[model samples]
Target chain A: MSGNENREKYKLNVGKIYEGFVIDHIHAGRGMKLYKDLGLEKLDCSVAIITNASSKKMGKKDIIKVECPIDRFDLETIGFMDHTATVDVIKDGEIINKPKLSLPKTVKNIIKCKNPRCITSIEQGLDHIFVLTDPEKEVYRCKYCETKYGEQ
Target chain B: MRHLLTPLDLSVEELETLMDNAEKIKADPEKYAHVCDGKIIATLFYEPSTRTRLSFEAAMLRLGGKTMGFATADSSSAAKGESVADTIRIISCFADIAAMRHPKEGSATVAAKHSRIPVINAGDGGHQHPTQTLTDMMTIRALKGHFDGMTIGLCGDLKFGRTVHSLIRALLRYKDVRFILISPDELKLPDYMTDEIKRNGAEYEEITKLEDAMPRLDILYMTRVQRERFFNEEDYVRLKDYYILDMPKMELAKEDMIVLHPLPRVNEIAVEVDEDPRAKYFEQVQYGMYIRMALICMLLDISL
Candidate 1:
């Protein structure tokens, strides 16, 4: 009964499916909550208890296992989702992987610009491509939008 | 010469050649006028631009070249559903080289692919206007003799400034230059370019107050801020009018500093400063045509 609360035996799989991006995770005391967030697809119960073995190291009698399926995802270059935009990763009626998304170089149009008056978005036939100039700074800007990421 | 596609297509040496010759031509316009005699420059504006299109035409005509092409897209094959590539192909047959203005970002890139003659991108869909970059080079050269070791202040709409973006890209090719970027929080320089600043190891400082940066700048480039861009009008109304440069700001700027705007300015700089010798924007505007003339002549494969 006491082992149910101790956290251990955690692992994350960033299947080669989402190639260009990392479906990352940081585990420790927070490992279980993060694991449950990316829970197994098709599981009916919000809380599923996995079989735990008693471990003296964990100071618990049992360890719960959290499993998730990256079912059928193919690593594509373009990004397709974000937080609060909860969407199920589906392919051929089967559940796949879910990940946060950001656009790569392949986008063909400008959805937004930093300059409201600039002609790119107001006009047609213009595609906005953003190059990741600084990865550490977390900056993304329109090739044409000129509206920089976190520009201030 | 011929068709300015993306700035990435040309080597730094090639851009320098254009700037060098443009300076020589600027010194003696009559010396290079006959080089393109009988050549016809077709504006082919698939959009409305009196400044750039006319400058292209004037550049050709000033160099003893002829001029023709639609000033508006509604009057051209574009209205007939003609593709940009086909129009450029057909135009190349009549003109020795073409200075084109299209509203599409990479439209000139597509035109450059098909045309037999060289293509000059007068302006593209807010993507790039390499000629404006040429004008900036011409301005820098005419003022500073070389692009190196100058401190330039770029203010207003840096976030989406096509001219600012092109000039920054071009300036990165040189050495020992620094930048002071001034604009409102909403109109800050785009991160893509700032990312470039970081990668190139260029020194740059971003600030909200133009007055704060004015004293240290050697060159000042200004762009218009339209009220319509703001998602909220109240913010625009509060900030737009006060952003203009007046007598007070000029005193804070260096005596050697030159003021430049990409034209069609709607009161960004005060009219009082126009009479000052350093108000080089009008001269910059005129120099724009001359550099363009130089560009047209070279791209057309004409010599001397």
Candidate 2:
């Protein structure tokens, strides 16, 4: 009914962690992907993903709550996925910091280079890295082949 | 520690120095014959480019250095699924420097990252070929005497032509260099390249017809439609003969206009055009050796 009510509803859905991160305002349907990209599943800690959550800023959004330390958390993955997403640092049952996320200058082992002709495609055990070449255009090119991401 | 993965690896001043070194080597090659006497060069060509391979080998041999390596991917450890990183690391142990050509774009960069020695990119798949650009620049400087205020016409296969891309990038550093990009509609320069040209405030005109841009050109660069770059044989066949540089096209060019091609030309330049004094593609090949010789010396820190 109200902004506070919506916030309360989300808080009720996922319990607050003692020490971890709460990635909020993720674009709708990207929470699971962010979870996978961050490799949260591989972690031994409890992780909660909320999809299609109502947002005042964004019409709908996704949120991820990780019940673990922030040391292993990948902020670059979150930044590359959704720069608008707010990362809330939790400590002792309280939000200590709300760090702003922006597109990473370089992302490693996140988005894979799709260019078949790229060395990363054939080489085994190589990190798939992309560099933000054009910040204005938000263009990411494969560090190996220079092939722009999503290019045919 | 210095690797030539692209022409931009060297600054404008460094390029000028390298060019001067190349010119010196060209003038008196015998004087610097023993510059690389104890050096060893590993030519790791993971692609079949006989011209580039020979040019590198010749450059090394002329510098009194020994050359060793496989010519094709099948003949190398790459055929056994060995990564470029591993091959280059191994090559670094045996050779003082390495020149590598691979079918995959940015393969040289990967090799360079793992190499303990200097890595020279001979040619990568439809990507930047710095050595070829060096050769082109050397030829232009020798023939035209300067890079500024030159209207260079680049004809055919601009999209997949690595030399065209590299040459454009290298020439864009100069003042008042206009580019007449002559290529078919489907094979025009890539949008990213055009964007770079515009971003650098370089003047360029894209035209489909070669003759239309010929007469006003100071340098006419012809490129073969690379069959290897094409995914389909039908597309390759259709574009292969799009813009042939012949006597008719040469007739339209300016008298002082020098023609350059990164060779292994396949019907792109007719035999008739080869007789013209303006056709300096063969001289381009010779410059390729000289520039490479200069490049090896620069990379190896060998001063003569």
* Model 1 C-alpha lDDT per residue in residues B29-80, reported as the tens digit of each score: 8888777888887778887888998888888888888988898889997888
For each predicted model, how many residue pairs clash, with residues at least 3 apart or on different chains?
Answer: 13, 0
List-wise, what DockQ does each model earn?
0.09, 0.74
The best candidate in terms of DockQ:
2
* Position B19, candidate 1: lDDT: 70
Candidate 2 lDDT by residue in tens digits, B1-304: 7999999999999999999999999999999998999899999988888888899999999999999999899999989999988999899889999999998888888988899999999988888899999999999999999999999999999998999999999999999999999999999998878988999999999999888998899999999998888889999999999988889888988899999999889898999998999999999999999999999999999885
| Docking quality category of candidate 1 according to DockQ thresholds | incorrect
TM-score of candidate 1 to 2 decimals: 0.69
Model 1 ranges off by over 4 Å: A1-152, B227-239
Output the lDDT of residue B179, model 2: 96
Per-candidate TM-score against the hidden true structure: 0.69, 0.95
Span of 10 residues, lowest total lDDT, candidate 1 chain A: A12-21
Q: Interface root-mean-square deviation for each candidate? A: 5.2, 0.9
Q: Evaluate model 1 with DockQ and give the value.
A: 0.09
TM-score of 2: 0.95
